[model samples]
Target: MKYFYYLLFALLLCGCQETKKEKISRLVNEWENKEILFPKNSFFTIFAKDTIAFDTVDCDYKVFTYIDSTGCTSCKLQLLKWKGVIAKFDSLTHNNTAFLFYFHPKSAKEIAYILKRDNFNYPVCIDDADSINKLNQFSDEMMFQTFLLDKENKVLAIGNPVHNPKIEKLYLKLAMGESYTDKPILSQTKISVDKEMINLGTFDWQKKQQVAFTIRNEGDQLLVINGVTTSCGCVSTEYNHEPVQKGKNLKIQVSYKADHAEHFDKTITIYCNVPSSPVKLRIKGDARK
Candidate 1:
């Protein structure tokens, strides 16, 4: 009778251990795969121990915490200073604007605590445990991946973080309304233009007309206009000088010769620093005899 009781007790203990292990495994799995969304239409910032800092239009800074494990001890969490811009992108929260951050056990613990403490009210993501473990093995190195998506979750910009300095500049560019590409850093500067769009009314195709466009350097730094080009040979442009200084204006005289004129439309692209992307000017009119 005593032997039967002992066997039953052993079975119960074994079953309890198995159940406990399974429960722990499930929790860990969920933590690894958890996906939390930021507060919709809300703005928040993210800071890191490394480079990168984000501020909203109001210029509010973000705070973060870090965790480190010592030997066989539990993790320890410490608050970090505000570093870079990891803010919410109001209407720009499409997949293209979303950024992913991979963290290790220590970093993950700190991140998890932040997520829970903040009620998961921001646009940040925590990596899975498998990725965390891999990062742990490669502690001396850092890696990151950024994806830019359109409204339908289509990726527009895909950048792999390797070097620190290069990534820092890339983040700044994205923050300032530029899309990421595999191309090198072409230019960075400031410029002043009368308007983003130009409208030239109707003109006789048999006559020639000249219009003046001004380019200024409103920024604190020097502005460089490398060159200008038009779609057709009928149009020509001349600049004031090579490099335009701050607070100075360069006159771009555009002369259009009304030869073989019908409904005329042309686009001119000015490659410069103020607007790092591209500047387009339009000229349109009806050619009358």
Candidate 2:
């Protein structure tokens, strides 16, 4: 009986382990400076103005993410927004930013049809089967998955490329070899919040409830936000990593998903050096089935 109990406990622990997708999701706004595996592949075609091979391109600041169009319409729309966001950056930006789209089609004809129909004016890779399978390992439907990786391939940010303009600026700062600091070391401090509660309105059962508010430091001291944690695992929060100077601002985006159609009312506690200390942020909304 003792041995059986121990085995059962081990099995329970194994079942509770977070999957790869969850691990990746947690990397949002973290600059771990880790390298991601870029497999060599021969099944890719580019429709951009310049005929560049996938393997030859650099990965200094690659947008390493997948866009599985086989999902819902909103996801497809977000993908389109990403494409537009990438297009805004000129060739000069391309030197550092590589929009790595991962696609795995079962048939060559399907691939041809997609390419011919979409006429995507950017680089696309026919990701290896192993990579495709690894992504599919995630149980949830992949929607507008985007990971902003630094030169070392560490995660810098996640979500749509244009989701946050400041993120793009932060990427430029890193690419230019400048450390991100909101204000001078000596003169940095105050806590200013634009809103305490943000109404997300309504989200479809398939959609995640997301909203953001501006956080500013209104005093002459450096405000260091150590972390922003939600009430539960289904709620994911992201914010800037750099110091918040007296004059500068940072946006905190909060998103949550549920297993059923119901009302969501959650709070995210923000831990920072400011006098506000731990600000209790709230989010309320209705998610329809």
RMSD of each: 27.0, 12.1
Residue-level lDDT for 164 in candidate 1: 23
TM-scores for all predictions: 0.35, 0.42
Which stretches of model 1 miss by more than 4 angstroms? 1-187
Clashing pairs in 2: 188-221, 188-222, 189-219, 189-220, 189-221, 189-222
Model 2: weakest 10-residue lDDT segment is 6-15
Count residue pairs with overlapping backbones in model 2: 6
Tens-place lDDT per residue, model 2, 1-289, is 1222222221222123457445434433232333455554434457422346565346466776664535322223234445555665435465667766666544435544445445555666655364753733422334225555666665554443343343444445555555654332343357778999877778786787777878878887777876564554356678889987668889998877764676767777676665444567888888887
Candidate 1 lDDT, tens digit per residue, 1-289? Answer: 2222222221232224676645434433332312222223222234222233432224211111112232211111111101112332323333223333433344545455554443433433233343333432322211212322233333222222211223333434454456544333444667767765455667677688788788777777667764565544456677765777778888888877754556777666575655443466767677667
- Predicted structure 2, TM vs. truth: 0.42
